[model samples]
Target: METRELRYFVAVAEELHFGRAAQRLGIAQPPLSRAIQQLERRLGVKLLERTNRTVTLTEAGSVLLREGRAALDAVDAAERRTRRAALAATGQPGLVLVTKAGASSELLSKLLDAYAAEPGAVTVDVHLCGIGEQERLLRDGRADVALLHRPFDSTVGFDTEDLRTEGQVAVLPAGHPLARRAGLRMDDVTALPDLPLPRWPGPDGTYPDGPGPQVRDHTQLLQLVGLGRAAAVLPDSCRAHLNADLAAVPVLDAPTVTTVIAWPPHSRSRALAGLVRAATLL
Candidate 1:
């Protein structure tokens, strides 16, 4: 029933001799014989036929010899693998940056491209999900780390790095009056006929000089602006128009969107720390 009893039974079974098995196991013969007897008593099976002149394995003893050796071998392998994994974790395992769907498209691609340009450095993988969902994954330990345009709450169990700052530009129809110049001052687009903005963070009136009309999403607002239906200011990284006639011009008064890479506080994993280090040049 117990591992030590199985070990003793295996040794005795292999040798088919009492004194030699005990000597090999570095145990006394009396205790070794008693251990084998206890094992058979527990299993309710006779394992060996023994006499003062000779010893021989029974049917059950042969089966146990094969299984016991396999069990001991498996235990040894498991212990070794666990020790190796612990060492690797202490040394800082390789990283994967789980980000919001839009965050990676903005900066993560450049960061990885730079990292990959150097052939021999440590590797990091990039993943993306919605901002709210990614935060949940980090909290529940389903994900090792996160990066997003939005701030992460402390209760979500994360440390964050505010890598860099950038501003958004207003997307307007190419033929619109504001789009004629290379860039427009905040005053130029602020007075547009009708402007659309995404519904988030705060009410549409949150802007000091609230634009008259607003749409529910940025990309859609941009498409409307390109079609001369409306105008809106959005993050520069947002490409509302690629082939159609729309132009993005800088908006001077808009606040910069801060991008962050966040992870659980003092995680057993070093995914966040490693990624932040590799991204220092950013």
Candidate 2:
């Protein structure tokens, strides 16, 4: 019921091992086990099933895990917003904008230029983050706005305006057979046994189970493609950065990626509003 209890429960639920969870939480194992027991008693439900070798969640634990995560995110957001407000009260003249590194470079340039040209624009601090990090940054008040690519990034809890949309391309080695084709469909690239698609890390930093090499960003993905080690589907704008060894072919059936300017729904800063307006008008 309390935030501390929820935190402990979430940690144990995630790790499924009291010792590991305790290590993660910087506390002793027995105390962490006791806290979970106390939490279960207070709720009058068996949250975890434990044995000599393994620990697993019960049905109630599964439900509580989901809801408790949301509750904790809300608490973190509240604390971050409060701190941000206190900082702003001291007359800081800037807003932090976050975006995926190496993405939407041209659009970002134009957006920054347009926003700077506004009559009362504040200093804009741009933060380049790894994939899937922008949403977290925005939710926790580390960033005031973000440029997110739809279908790649979730916009569930924010307000967004479409900036641009473009089709995807398959990035391959210049000498590959597919590189000579004028165009291709998704089927042309997906099942290439010789060129497995690279695996990207999920938000939790774990690579999905796959046969391909794991990559963290577009740069690494391109390098892999250039080495003929992997193939990747990327937004068309990425072609601007491709070297001669890399070739891009339009994937006729791939979904179009829409770049959007997103912000927290409850944001009330005048500078953030101005920046969003500037982006939309471009």
Question: Per-residue CA lDDT of candidate 1, range 1-282, in tens?
Answer: 677887888888888898999999999999998888888888999999989878898888889888998787556545644563475568745555576554347477777776666544455655565424555555544555566554232333357777766777877777767676777666777666555443332311243335444443444555566677766666677663333588778887777776676765655534345456656667
Model 2 agreement with the true structure over 121-180: per-residue lDDT tens digits = 988999988778888888877788999999989999899999999999999999999999
Candidate 2 residue runs with Cα over 4 Å from true position: 26-34, 52-54
- In candidate 1, the residue pairs with backbone N, CA or C atoms under 3 Å apart (3 or more residues apart, or in different chains) clash, namely none
User: TM-score per candidate, in order?
Assistant: 0.48, 0.92
Residue 232's lDDT in candidate 2: 92
Q: Give the TM-score of candidate 2.
A: 0.92
